[model samples]
Target: MSSPLPLVFDAPKRGLPPRHLADLTLAERTEAVAALGEKPFRAKQLSRHYFARLNVDPAQMTDIPAAARERLATELMPQLLTEVRSVECDDGATRKTLWRAHDGTLLESVLMRYPDRATLCISSQAGCGMACPFCATGQGGLQRNLSTAEIVDQVRSAAAVMRDGVLPGPDGKPAPGRLSNVVFMGMGEPLANYKRVVAAVRRITDPTPSGLGISQRSVTVSTVGLAPAIRKLADEGLQVRLAVSLHTPDDELRDTLVPVNNRWSIDEVLQAAKYYIDRTSRRVSIEYALIRDVNDQPWRADLLAKRLREHLGYLVHVNVIPLNPTPGSKWDASPKDVEREFVRRVNEGGVTCTVRDTRGQEIAAACGQLAAEN
Candidate 1:
């Protein structure tokens, strides 16, 4: 009899490599190295190279004996991703890279450098299952959950680029800065790949020599209101910020814009957001994409602020994103007057709000637009 076909919802599982250095804890890394017939202490050296130095080239590993470097490189430091193409903007301050995984699974990540900070936006999944109509990543559907290493590798590469003065800015010089922040806001809904996303966060926030050691406060994980996952992350002892993508105020329009609303209504999602704030004391960010004639209205903004005050009180900030129209999509940003009025009404109801800065539109840097082009 033929084997049953894999479920349509099953995540892509073929391209990932055998468990490597990234999937381990400090102790586990030592154990893994010992298991490979090397001294356990060598694990620290490798970790220092990978995490502290962001160096993956085993040939330059002088600390490890010349004889053993080849074996370790062959066994431990196998290439996880190869850069396919890189699109840059803002005089190279913003860069988006398309990567082909070991088995040819395609994924993308963006790195941006500014005067104050360098931020790397990486994908947690190859594609997303959340069918938010306006989002390119969601419309592509779920391909597979990216491995924890795959997620971490994106940050490592961006950090390396920043360190090496690769990205040029205006006035034709490399911006002297290091990666200061990371956001899992590319190509997929991070929470949908729950376990791996959390693991990636651990690897990101843990102190260097164990991981990249970025501050927990600098990491932001965004979701389109995955209720249970929101509650679970609150209990994870992580200080990372939580961003809820609530495209509309009421259940009526949100149900159509964010289909996940069909399962969990506006009230249920807000309650969960409240739970996060009560438990963590970290401000939750509400993401509202302003689409013309759809959910952008003065009264809807009033209702959004009213409900947020009634539920979450002062523990939330609403980030209004002016819709960046895809090629032929009817949805577009609201006029300046409409947007200002909406913000005024929201502030009148006592909730803080601001418009998000648009970056990389010239190169289709808004979420899944790049993936769609490829």
Candidate 2:
């Protein structure tokens, strides 16, 4: 049978902005600045203001000559995202922002603050082309891949919000904290936009004056079992966590749920994941969304555990996500009892499993829900 999945990476580029500082390396930035008739050191100043201090306003960059600030900002710091609206929930600990790109494309990024760490879930593309029937984003199909700067800007914006005490804490007070974690679980299959996503990761984990300086361990890049891409990422020599959205263990069920499974079988994906673990020495995360009466059968869970144990052997953890049913969709989350049993069976087979904490349901925080509604 012909594959149902849409090839997303080659999608047409529309409204992608001109080159910005975030898209360039330090040397490249220096060259870009000099092209504007400024000294090489000006690039470092701009990087400090944007990446290190999270400030982008040209008016506040007093260190640079006033005449050059506007020119540099206009060229290097072009505004990429404009907030359309922001909604908060979970006692003000979770905030989701709807951003309008230059081309009027709508994308979303969620900032969720927990007791121990704050995590930002950012989108890698405007819409997804994986065609996973259950996913709101996937259902809409791919719009275009986000540029490297656009991806990095989301993290920088969230980190600024955390540092500036913009979002309220669980105690209902403006509690400033660090943005410690980032997950590429928002809209597109991250690995589909492989080059930009990899560039974004480097811009996120590199230390001050170069990038965001967040530890690689704190960043998680999720994919829907793109086996070759998984192996390619393993060789990047970074410690960032890898999450596979393997909703089912059996090729039969997975082929229907995750359309990409038709191309890369479950065993092939798992073997690639094993290669990742062997190379990175970091535990892989298996994300399984439990749909009612679908892939949530206890026996499937047992098979999931068995397959994982045979391949990963304690080097993996299963994050069982209760289905966030789309509006008017037939799919529904598995019952609590069924969910519990699924977890139980996975553990019984010698693999760790837990139900993930579902957040921002009220604000359409699950993937492309907000953009779809808008």
Candidate 3:
């Protein structure tokens, strides 16, 4: 057996912005407003404006009194993300935004509109510390963990965009739609910033006038096999889906592909995932990124299926992602035939497997590609 690798979760040292409405609970927001020499009810009013109406500008907050609106906005709703640029593809159904944080940190979010539902992939941290050699964001290293509000605001902004019919549809015109799904498969390892990410999840799923009112079932949080954190999240009593980025199943290759595997091997990660399933009763998503000449061998697929069947049985599904190659990287997506056979072998091994739909590939929308260029 390999010795457990040391885990060093380091976030860049930086001052986060002052308190924002999304950062606080209703009770906390009430206290914050009271601290600003205002009545407690004012907090509810502000929450309604931000969370329900998705309006942040003081000038647009008609419900609040003219005298108090500016002060309230200034104190509680300070601007968090300034859009640096937006790129679109897939007949404008997919859009990616590069946002500059208040402290000038750069992060990105991708909004992908499908025929049935619109999904937004938002970042929990500016860059990643996972150190996966093939990932663009991981190659950059961690900048900082985004504040709770910073994380929630990305969804709020994307939701507002969908509601207002800003992005074009397959018809090549502005087609109004609703933001239906939110995935944390963006720039960082979400569970690494446990508290803030959990708080953001609450702010996302809680009912309107308190949160965006998106159903908890509509959210998916992905991790790179953080065993202890996965168990911790299961205990949170959330129905949100759990996705483990098991790039490879065998310990030897996984230790190189997902360095955290050295700390908690494949068996440990699978055990943790099973714990999550037992607690949440929701099927876990095993995310496998297939890279040519890397971890895409049919034998590995069979091994993955055998292990998953032993641990999770039918309580798990595999999403095989074709590697979205970064610039100048030797790693690339596997051949179409190889990908199909790999999926076939996994299914033959008694675990269901399917290819994940690759979206926004042209615009660098997949996982860590965006942060790599910026």
RMSD of each: 3.9, 1.2, 1.3
TM-score of each: 0.95, 0.98, 0.97
Q: What is the lDDT of residue 127 in candidate 3?
A: 89
Best lDDT among the predictions, by candidate number: 2
Best by TM-score: 2
Regions of candidate 3 where Cα sits further than 4 Å from its true position: 1-8, 170-172
- Tens digits of per-residue lDDT for model 3, 268-321: 999999999999999999999999989989889999999999999799999999
Residues forming the 10-long window of minimal summed lDDT in candidate 1 = 1-10
Tell me how many residue pairs clash in candidate 3. Answer: 0
Q: Which tens-of-lDDT digit does each residue in 1-374 have in candidate 1?
A: 22332223347565566576787788988887898899999989988998899999987899999877777767777788899899999888899999888877778999988777889999988888778888877778888888898999999999899988898744569855688899988978888888888999999999989999999999999998878989999999999999999988898888779877777778888898899998889999999999998999788999999999998999899999888777877778899898988888888889999988878989888777887788
Q: Model 1 off-target regions past 4 Å?
A: 1-15, 169-172
Decide which is better by TM-score, 2 or 3: 2
How well is each residue in 1-374 modelled by candidate 2, as lDDT tens digits? 45644455565667687788999998899999999999999999999999999998999999999999999999999999899999999988999999998888889999999888999999999999898999999889999889999999999999999999887766778988999999999989899899999999999999989999999999999999999999999999999999999999898889889988988999999999999999999999999999999999988999999999999889899999988989988999999999999999998999999999999888888899999989
| Ranking of models by lDDT | 2, 3, 1
How much lDDT does each candidate structure score?
Answer: 0.86, 0.93, 0.91
